[model samples]
Target: MKAISYSRYGGPEVLEFGERPDPKVGPDKVLVQVRAAAVNPVDWKAQAGYLDTIFDTVFPVIPGWDVSGVIVQPGVSVTEFSVGDEVMGYVREDVLCHGTFAEYVAAPVRTLARKPRNLGFEESAALPLAGLTAYQALHRALHLRSGDTLLVHAASGAVGSMAVQIARHLGARVIGASRDEGQDRVRELGAEPVPYGDGFTARVRELAPRGVDAALDTVGGQVLKDSAALLAPDGRLASIADGEVIALGGRYYWVRPDTDDLTALAGLVEGGALTVRVAASFPLERAADAQRANMEGGLHGKVVVTVDHDH
Candidate 1:
């Protein structure tokens, strides 16, 4: 099948569009006909070897994790889904290869979830990783509850925007930190917008003088520190961007593929409590461009790569 891959760790220049061997289905997996895939910063980072120490890279690696597609065939042991099922997943395996940027992917059942009935493939593709990251951080890590006040750093980002909506849906009053250009977006996502950079802590404190009940740091570094200090004594803190969050007495989270969590996010989308914005899109052959677009930053939503199966 035709796909985007790189034989060595490098920048977008190393990515090539060509035919790769089709994946074999495992007993616990299904073959999905790719419809769309979303580009995350991690995709480019991993391709650049930033995550070399963490994951073993197989040469000619296919680089994508978020997918929205249809099941063409299920594994012999599969029963949770069958042929023709529309699904979305954060299809990260233990190793780097056989990813979603191809015409098809052999996805493990544990990573699959029914796509939100209300969204298109591109939008659905955008949800799994970013949505799951926000959901797990707010619900599991932070234990956010109704009436609590929450602070979100980098609130206009892919994960941060999702966090704002999920926190608000959980009934928390949200204060979001972003740049001046992103302030309106943060407000639209149901958070009171606060500017980043100097005095970020002061801005948040102005919104919640007693300190927030919890804080989610998606920007890391000084933002993580500020988030920890802004907590209301026992306030919860978690960061997806920085591992130093652990040293600051907070959990540093890395998103995982969980069917249940993805399904819950789907429910939120169908219920109109969550929405995905597609900032840009490219065809499958141009996936390198998609990665570059995501890396360029300043996007309020996701960069997606669409697969054309009609041919």
Candidate 2:
């Protein structure tokens, strides 16, 4: 099978596109013919070896986690899905290798969920990582409730955008912080937009003078500090980017694969409560280019790598 991999931890320059042996299917796993894969900042961070202490990395790693594909073979123990089922998943494991960047991936059943029928493969591919990050932060960490007020840092980015929509669906009045250029789009997603940087808390205060009931930080650094300061006395806080949030009485979360959570996201999409924004799509062979685009920044949504299995 054709795949892109890096034998050593480095930048996009180290990635190589070539033929590799197909993954062996195991019990409780399914062989998925990759239709599309989404690139996230973690993909590059992993490549650069930033997460080496956390996730076990085998050299010559296939670097991707989010995939939308069709099952070609279901493992003997897999019962929820059969061959020909359309699915999307966040396929992270304790170890890094055998990922969605290839023509196929052997995905564990715990990570797979039926893709939202309303969306295309590219859109579904973009959801698992970022969508789950946002969903888990709001629904689990923040414990967001209807009529509550929520503030999201970096609201226009991939995870932040989903946070805004999911918070709205949870019946929260959302305030999203982004650049001046992204404020309009942030507002369109049902959040009151505030520009980030100095005086950010003041801007948020102007919108919710009493302070927000919860805050989710996607951009780290002083943004988390500001979020901590602007939270209501009993407000909840969670950060995916900044571990320092834990020091400031907030929760730090790394997204985990849970098919139940993915199912909820799909239900939101099917019900017209959630939508995915795809910034660009590249062919599977151009995985490096896709990674480069993600690293370059200013993308309003996800960068997807599409596989041409028919060819």
lDDT of 2 by residue, 1-311 (tens): 99999999899999999998899999989999999999999999999999989888888799899999999999998889998999999999889888889999999999999999999999999999999999988877888999999999889999999999999998899999999989998999999999976787788899999889999988888888888999889989899989999999999998999999999999999999999999999999999999999999898989999999787
For candidate 1, what is the lDDT? 0.93
Report lDDT (Cα) of residue 306, candidate 1. 99
Error of 2 at 148 (Å): 0.8
Deviation of model 2 at 129, angstroms:
0.6
Worst 10 residues of 1 by lDDT: 196-205
C-alpha local distance difference test of each model: 0.93, 0.93
Candidate 1 lDDT over 9-49, as tens digits, reads 89999999999999999999999999999999999999999
